[model samples]
Target: MKTFSNRLYSDYLMPSRMTTHEDLIRAAQVAGYTQTSVRDFVATLRGGRDPQHKVLIHRHDIDTDLRTARKLFDLEKKYHIQSSFYFRLSTMDIRLMREIEEYGSEASYHYEELATFAKRNKIKDRADIQRRMPEIRDEFVRNFEWIEQRLGRKLTTVASHGDFANRQLKLNNTEVLADQALRARCGIECETYDQILTDHTDIYISDRPPPQYYHPVTPIDALRRHRRIYLLTHPRQCETNWSANTKDNLHRFYEGLTW
Candidate 1:
């Protein structure tokens, strides 16, 4: 189980995010999660056998980015990886969401909803955000409705968007779970890594990297050590073109490590 330091780097940041799909497959073969399509991923999830590969795919922020949606769909067709796409539902690309939803790729809400709701569509910085949680979530119900309307499907799973820069946004893991749970009570079913693991102990679930914090040690290492490893990637943040910091971060984490 090598660390996530030296992952084969490819991103869909370009209109051509899928050109490296083969490279990624080869890399996954090297990492050993040789899954090539959605069924393979499902089998990993449903079967007792561990996944045969350790892989990560990044799509670069699926907001109005239809290019990413289309490209990811195409690549998923080729590789059989039923990866997850995270969307910033508040300011998300609705058109892109509509397009991506058809591909059978699972979608998760990236909670920019809090910032959009709390700030009254006006707040922008972290200090203002942290100082305003009560004032914000208290006043932000519309944002939730907005998200529900946009996705067309109710959001059952959510990942917090990296938001410290936008609002002094500190999320308590439990608090986030509770907030999501309240929504679930209304049939929204918002679940996170902790919630899934705590409730579903019989199933071998993959909670490798914590949401939005993608240092890939556990996930990649998990792949190496376990037979049924699962890996996830972000579409909006993993390419060199989108954010050099994220690229460098992944490169450093997976730097010299090989499968």
Candidate 2:
């Protein structure tokens, strides 16, 4: 297995890192990820395209930093690529969302309603969560409605924000939207990472882990495999300087704890 140090050194030594976002562009042009947005992927499905093509869905979960999200938007625009940017309601900005949409990208909710409710209400028991399922679903509906109204369109999809800390309590945010009636009422489709795997048989690659850490399949590996790809990245992760990005993310996380 390649170590993180090895990967860091390799990235530092690579020339493609210096020019015009070459590394990512090369991943699409030469490495065969075939950069795609979630909207386009859905359209292809609706149009009944062969699902076996080397499709790559560029998915971004904008957890906190909208500034970095803008930077990423510009980068994708420069390359004539489109992607999906999922924003938490807490971080939703109408102007920024519109700007991203104008760049030919799609916007959707990154939901954590159940987990947020559990934390806010101090609900810890499994039985308590089960009993509150209806309430949780209501909260999701309210939140989805607010976002949809702000976006000025009915949302076509959503993705769950994995609440790792709440997983021990078996309180999954996605579960709140599991009721088909609730989904229909919201007029939205949910696409969690698990669903993406099940639906497309796509290989997943994420830059959430530092570049040094080994992923099950690296971007290069996924490209070589020629499989459908669901590529998730935080905009901060793609910053030109990885070390600086890490430092900023840690600082932001600390600030969030205090805020």
Candidate 3:
């Protein structure tokens, strides 16, 4: 394990700037890209149709922070933009999800059922997970419906969330969605990684790749080159709060010890 001093040094080097995320959103709008939520993006491309204008699909994976989620939510709202927020079960907040929908944005599940199941059952083998696919699918359905029932709206899209178990087990939460029958039964129309959207997407940029936590090319530069783009961010990684970052680092370090 990395020592406490090393962890602190690494955390201090992490780049998290909310203003950078905000700047990208504003730049996309100015560049004539219509920012839309994943739900809206799917609806627009329904029935095998093409979008009439340039589109910027913006989304946030609310990994761990509700405060950061609201900050990003408000920032987009300030510019009259509707984006997507995929909430993990860890950070699920009904009131905030309602607010997102009230303002014309999407608040849907950021599913990690497979990972959750693996950890809970302590099953790490590929065959074990494959054999337990039925139960895994059921877990996903329950979670999906749970969110919808509480949010009081139908979910048109879902984004698969990754976790430590997923990496260790060499599995993805998205595997559950591979069952077309299950997807139809659950009324899921689009996944964040659905090929339909990926085919239309010319490029994908995200506030990922630790420490810096941003794409190499700025959103403005990318917008100048691509007509259809997918922009994803995690508010916790993008927020400009040194104290919150310190807390996050500590939490991660604790998680590492247990894992």
Q: Name the best candidate (by TM-score).
A: 3
Deviating ranges (above 4 Å) for candidate 2: 1-22, 31-33, 194-197, 211-214, 240-259
lDDT of 3 by residue, 188-254 (tens): 9999999988888888887654444558665677888999988888876665446656676676566
- lDDT, candidates in the order shown: 0.45, 0.69, 0.83
Task: Please tell me which model should have the higher lDDT, number 1 or number 2.
Answer: 2
> On residues 88-187, what C-alpha lDDT tens digit does candidate 1 reach at each position?
5433666655655666556646555454443344544545556655554543345556766767876554555544323244543223334553555535
The per-candidate count of clashes, in order, stands at 37, 0, 0
TM-score of every model?
A: 0.54, 0.80, 0.89
Error of 3 at 158 (Å): 0.4
Q: Select the stronger candidate by TM-score from 1 and 3.
A: 3
**How many angstroms is residue 37 displaced in model 3 relative to the true structure, after the best TM-score fit?**
0.6
For candidate 2, write residues 122-225 as lDDT tens digits.
77787888898898888888888988788786677788887643575776677877788987888765455546444774667766435442257666676777
Q: After superposition, how far is residue 136 of candidate 2 from its true place, in Å?
A: 1.0
lDDT of 3 at 139: 90
lDDT leader: 3
User: Candidate 3 — which pairs collide?
Assistant: none
